[model samples]
Target chain A: MNPADRALEDLFQEVGPERAPSHLHARILAQLADKAEIRTVPAPLLARWQWILIGLAAMGSILLAVMLPGNGSSTGWIALLMDHLPDMTSISSTLRTTLIGGAVISGILYVLDAQLNTRVRPTHG
Target chain B: MVYTVTHRILRNDMDAEEATQDTFLKAIRGLHTFQGGSRFSTWLYSVAYRTAISRSRLRRTEDRSLDEVEGRPGEPGSEAQGTTSDRRRALEHALSRLTPEDAAVVTFHYLHEMSVDEIVTATGLSASNVKVKLHRSRKKMLEILQEHLKEEVWTLRTE
Candidate 1:
C-alpha cells in the first residue's frame, strides 16, 4: 500500500469501531433462553427415512419394469434404453418422461428456492 | 464490531441493534460446528458482516450518506458536528460518497485489520473481487480527501 493508502488506514483506525447499545447484550441473552427449547427443528414434509424408502421404491419399480417380459419393438428397445437411460422413445417413454420431467422441475425449483431465499432465517441453527 | 459494521451500513440505531443481536445469536449457535479452521474472531466477523448486509437489504429506511454527522445530515462537517478534526470529517465525507458495500469493504480491510482472503470469506466475495474493491475504494478515498483538504485551506484563507 502507498503512503496515502496507509494514511487512510490510519484514519480508519482513528475512527475505531462504534459502540453498541448496552441493552443489546441483555436482549440477545433473553431471546436465546426462549429459543433453547426449539433447537431441533425437524425438516419439513418428508422425513429422512421416508425419503430413502421412496427412492428405493422408485428404483425397484424401474428394475421390475425393465425385467418384465416384453414382445416386439420393446425387446431391442429395452437393450438400447438400458445403454442410453435418457432415451425417452422406449416402451417406458411415458414413465421415463414423467420421472425425468419431475426430477428436472424439482431441481429447477430447488435452485430457485436456494437463490431467492438467501435471507437467513432467524433460527439458522 | 458487529454493531459498528451494522450501524455503518444501516445508519440506523434500531436496525443495527437488531442485527447485532441476530449476529451474536447466530455466532453462538454456530460455535459448535466451528472446527478451529480460522480464528474465532474471523468467523464471528463473517457472521456479523453477513447479518448486517442481510439487514440492510431488509431494512426499508431511507439511505443516508456517510457524510451525515451524528445529529446532522447533508452538511458533512457543520458546526453541529462537534470537536472532530477537519481531516476526519473529510474522510467520513469521502467514505460516505461510495456505495455502502464499498464502505463496508474498506472498513473490513483496514479498520478491522482483516486480510483480503478474510474479507472474501466474510463478504462471500471472490479474492480478486475483494482486491479490486479495495484498490478502487482507496483511490476514491484519496481523491475525496484531497478535495476536502483543498476546501479546508480555502475556508481558512478566507477566515
Candidate 2:
C-alpha cells in the first residue's frame, strides 16, 4: 500500500467505529422482548385447525346423509340433493328469512373478526 | 461489526446507531432464511450494509440533501494533538466528506480487513465491480488524506 493508505489503515485502527449508544441496546432488547412475548402467546385454535375441521365435518355429514339406506333409490349425491330441493322451499317464509339473515350476519362477523385479528397481529419481517 | 459498517455509511453516530439496531432486528427475523452458505459475520455485514444504505436513502428523501443531514465533523481534540487520536480524527473528518457508498467500500476494505470476494458477497456486487469500487474508494481516500493531512502524509512517506 502507498503511504496515504498505510496512514489511513493506522488511523482507522486507532479510532475504530463508535460504540452504539446505551439506549439503543435497550430499545433493541425491548423489541426482542415484545417479539418473544408475541411468539409465546399460542395462536388461536380457530386460526390453526378450525377450517380444516369444519370441511371434514361437512364432508362427513354429506356422506352420511346421502348414503343412508332408507332413501330406497340408487341415486347419485346430486340426484339426492335435487330430490330434497323442494323440502327446502317448503319451509315457512318467516323461518327461511330469519335463517338466511342469521347466516349472512354470522359470515360477515367471522370475516371481520379474521381481518381485525390479522391487523392487530405483530409482524416480523 | 454492524455499527462499524453503518457508521461508515451514515456518518452520524445517531443514524449509525439506528441502522445498527435495524440490522440486528432484520437479521433476527430473517434468520430462518439464512442458508449458511457464507460466514455468519459476512451475512450480518450484508444486513448492516443494506440497512445503512436504506436509512441513508430515507434520510435523503426526508431532508432533500445528504450534505445537510450528515453530522458536522467535530473539531480535533486539543489534548490529543500530535497523537494517534488526532490522526484518527483527521481521517474520520475526511471520511465524513465521502459519499456513503465510497466510505462504506473503504471501510470494508481497510478497517474490516475484508477480501474483495468477501466484500462482493456483503455488498452484492460482482467481483470486478467490487475490485473497481475498492480501487476508486482507495484513490478517493488518498486524495482526502493528502488534502487534510499534508504534513502527516509527507512525514509517513519519508519514514
Candidate 3:
C-alpha cells in the first residue's frame, strides 16, 4: 500500500468505531414490538384458497369454451334469442361479436392492472 | 456499524439514525433468508449499506464541496499537531467531499475492514468494479488530506 493509504488507515483506526446514540436501541426495540403485534395475526388461509379456486374455475371455463365443439346450430341463450326475436337476428350477430371482443379486452386489462398493483408480501423462511 | 455506514452515506445525523432504524427493521423482517453463508456482520452490513443508498437516492441532497465544509483548516500548518479529534474532523471533511457510493466503499473497505469480495457482496458490484472504485476513492481521499493537512499527512506517511 502507498503512504497515503497507510496514513488513511491510521486515521480511520484512530477514530475507531462510532457509538450510536443511547436511544437508538430503545427505538429499535419499540419498532420490533409493534411489528411483532402486527405479525401475530395469521394470514387467512381460507380466503387465499377461495381466490385460488375462483381463478382456477375461471381458467377452466375459458379452456372449456375454447376446446368444446362448435355446432352450426345455435344453442341455449342464442337459440332462445333467435327463436323469439327473428327480426333482430341480423343486428344480434354484430352485437354478440362486439360483446365478446369487449369482454376479452376487459379481462386483459384487469389482469394487467392487478399485476401492476400487486405488492410482494415479505415471507419468513 | 449501521449508524456509521448510514452517516457516511447520508451525511446527516438525523437521516442516518432513521436509516439505521430502517436497516435493522429490514434485517429482522428478512432474517429468514440470511442463510449464514458468510459472516453475520457482513450480511448485516450489506443490509445497512443498501438501506443507506436507497435513502440517499430518495433525498437527492446536494453534497457540500471541500471548501463548503464548515471549519475547514485555513492553513496547512494549522493541522500539523493533528490530535485525535483533529484527525477525526479532517477525515469527516474528506469523506463529506466524496460521493455517497465512494464514501461507502471507503467506509466498508477501511473502517469496517471488509475484504473486496465482501464488499462485492455488500454493494452488488463485481470484483473488478469494486477494485476500480476503491482505487479511485483512496486517491480522492489522499488528495483531500494533502490539501487540508499537508504537513501532518506527510509526517504520518513517513512514520
Enumerate the chain B TM-scores of all models: 0.76, 0.82, 0.84
| lDDT digits (tens) for residues A1-125 of candidate 1 | 65665677777787677777888887888877766333443333544465566556656565645444342345566666655554444556566556556555555655555454453334522
Q: Which sections of candidate 2 miss by over 4 Å?
A: A1-4, A36-125, B61-71, B75-80, B150-159
Indicate the DockQ of the complex predicted as candidate 2.
Answer: 0.27
* Candidate 2 clashes between residue pairs 3 or more apart in a chain or in different chains: none
lDDT against the true structure, per candidate, is: 0.67, 0.69, 0.72
Error of 2 at A125 (Å): 13
lDDT of 2 by residue, B12-88 (tens): 78888878878888888778778898888888999999999988987866544644676457444445444656667
What is the per-residue lDDT of model 3 for residues A8-123, given as tens digits with 9 covering 90 to 100? Answer: 77778888766689999888888776663323334433454565665665565454333233424567765565456435444555555555565575467556545544534533
Q: State the lDDT at B138 in candidate 1.
A: 80
State the interface C-alpha RMSD of candidate 2: 3.9
Q: Which docking band does candidate 3 fall into?
A: acceptable
Runs of candidate 1 exceeding 4 Å displacement: A36-125, B60-75, B78-88, B149-159
Collision count of model 1: 0
Better of 1 and 2 by TM-score: 2
Taking chain A of model 1 alone, its TM-score versus the true chain A equals 0.31
Range of the 10 consecutive residues with the lowest summed lDDT in candidate 1 chain B = B150-159
Task: Flag the better candidate by lDDT, 1 or 3.
Answer: 3
Tens-digit lDDT string for candidate 1 (B23-142): 877887777867787777777878888888887766534444432435333224444232346655665677666666787888888888889887887788899988888888887877
